[model samples]
Target: MPHATIVEEFPKTALSRRTGDVLAAAATGPVCLTDHGKPRFVLMTMAQFERLSGRTDGRTEDWTRDLSPEEQALFLAEIDERMCDI
Candidate 1:
């Protein structure tokens, strides 16, 4: 199991910085960010991002490694499930 970090982007950090750090952490765990006292975005690691982006590294991608069709599908499903509440 992975440990997630939910951060309120107000007191100590801004949305942009947290957003960057969240990407790295997202590869390892879920990073939930908030704005205006409400949850606004969810971030996940590379694998999770890959599932979501279908591009191996989302928009800021630097490298590429193809995922098997089955693996990609499975991971994409996991990302979906992770994003769900209840």
Candidate 2:
């Protein structure tokens, strides 16, 4: 189950405050803010933001498509360690 978190939607004038709040909660996902029903701003967690930034040490490999339990555990352990360093 996912943890309950607060995502506030504020008007353009209050974008700065919303951004600050979202950055403070950087371990969670993004808090989406909109303008006239269109996505205007996305406040992402540090991890998410870093992934979006795209300058990462991540590698692409075919092994991710399908994995045995042991392979998955090792892969996830590596990812978790990487997450901590990030």
- Leading candidate by lDDT: 2
lDDT of 2 by residue, 2-43 (tens): 232335554555567665555444334456666777668766
- Model 2 scores worst on lDDT over the 10 consecutive residues at 1-10
Instruction: List residue ranges in candidate 1 displaced over 4 A.
Output: 1-15, 18-20, 49-86
**Leading candidate by TM-score:** 2
Residue lDDT tens for model 1, 1-86: 33335432332245465654554444445566666667677755446555455654353222223665445535654565675644
How many clashing pairs in candidate 2? 0
TM-score of each: 0.34, 0.35
Candidate 1 overall lDDT versus native: 0.49
- Each candidate's lDDT (Cα)? 0.49, 0.51
